[model samples]
Target chain A: MNYTDVFGEPTRGKYVIAGINVGMILRKDWTTHQQARDYLCDFDGEPQIVEGIDDEFIREKHKEYPHLSLADCEYMWTGAHFCEELLKFDGFMLHASAVVYKERAYLFSAPSGTGKSTHTKQWLDAFGEDAYILNDDKPVIRLLNGKAVVFGTPWSGKTDQNRNAGVLLGGICFLERADENWIKPVGAKDAAFGILNQTIRPGDKKRLVKLLELLDNVIKTTGVFRMGCTISTDAAIMSYDAMKGETRA
Target chain B: MKVKSDFVLKEVAGQWIVAPSGDASISFNAMITLNDSGAFLWKTLEGGASEEELVSALLGEYEVSEETARAGVRNFVEKIREANLLDD
Candidate 1:
């Protein structure tokens, strides 16, 4: 079957994420998820096509899930497809809450319900206008000209915090709950595991390889830390100072 | 016994990491890292080497005695077995 037979006539929408112009083509009248709508860019200039989900693949995924609606299936397929496609351009999705501070991006990653979002909120409270959430979840990170950059994606989680922007990645921190706020540097080997635990491991061999390569580059360039902290402004301040190489008082 | 076909060994940033690929990766949650000698053994086992062959390869590659090589192979094989990366 041809592409048209599976996805019908394609309706194209252009979006720029992580410095890549993606032309997303979907079935006619089927809108993308709400979170991605804000990133819609003018359909000009050369763009990469994000392959539409085929009926057979959708059916197979639905059979495995057995509970998701057709729309949910489309959303999941789009996200997965986008991630795989982005890998070709040296990009991958990171499951973390990213915030912008001092014109740089800081990512806080943890398991679900691990207070990643709450910790970023503390940054906002402490820094006021100096800090803001770039993406609450699933931001796209890319390696460009030997620098790792972070970009806001449309797949931000429940908080719906995202901006159509990019920043040079400053640091990545793994979060753990604790009574007192503390942050410490971690080695590359330990940081690799921490990043892998939060990354979405791809089922495709080529994509997984590319993802690992990109992650290795990120580890080499970015400062990685493990922060144990309470949900207080002090946690944000302490982590901020630690990331900036300040000695703990 | 042999290394499972789905496991792919990759060298990233001068470190060796083993991860599952294709459908197996969907449920394979753990990624294993190996040192230089461990990586050599892994490659040797992928060719379906037996315990004796592994020990022989270790001895040839490193300046170790046969007894030490045998003991090292035994420990390495046991570790991979616990990780479920071997098909016995």
Candidate 2:
């Protein structure tokens, strides 16, 4: 018997994020068309938000996202706390658009409005079904059995475009808008700074240490690049070729 | 000078990066990258060394001359100081 049995609703739920079962209480009913709707299930556990932020924090968030409903604010809070707790499981969220091409997941990270989604769309247009978005925003990279695998989660930012999928992370590219499409492999230190700019910065020593160790493993194991790209499909082909060793055929 | 308290130096793929750890990050929002000699100096700073100690450590480790090592240490220490990452 679960909370759905006693409460007659999905008040208690769990999601399989990055291969971890995360159970948390559903504070309110979300409207239809939520991506989270794809993964909600009845679960029995004490899986509330891990050291969840206080209501005052959510209230402050309301000012930041005043256009959203209270339920959305709760969702945002839950996602944040979830990423922080993810450190314990050897995973952390990279603020990137994850795309799977040839069974490998490539993540493109940039500041908001820098066209991570737009670049992915171009890949979709150029490659068609050969490439698909795993998550348009917020993909989890977890070191599993010595491999850095990227997982799509339910709480993707803005657009509700995500698949409950996990694939080996092919590479990570920090994107920048440029007149011409050019991509180059950056050294690990420069890539690390770019990485820090995109993800949630842990405030405690424990989580910070964990996050850095995970990054050390990931940096050694993955290809890191700085891509200066345009909005054309040529940009897509160029980046894909550079990162995956695949050229448009 | 010592490595600042509540900050950490991590090596990722042979490159060293220093950033604030724990609560130190709240105020400082930057990560300083270090070259090989700079990383060695940072490791020496962990034990709270003077500039001369840092120069000697570099001389003992690298094939570079004392002048070259001093210039490298000064360059690195200046950068961290500008970033406010050193404990003096």
What is model 2's native contact fraction?
0.67
User: Which digits, one per residue and each the tens of the lDDT, describe model 1 over residues A117-152?
Assistant: 999999999999989899998888899988888999
Computed on alpha carbons, the lDDT of every model, listed in order, comes to: 0.79, 0.79
User: Candidate 2 has which clashing residue pairs, if any?
Assistant: none
Error of 2 at A92 (Å): 1.1
Taking the tens digit of each residue's C-alpha lDDT, what string does model 2 give over A115-190? 9999999989999988899999999999999888899887788888898889998889999999988999987777
Q: How badly does each model clash, as a count of residue pairs? A: 0, 0
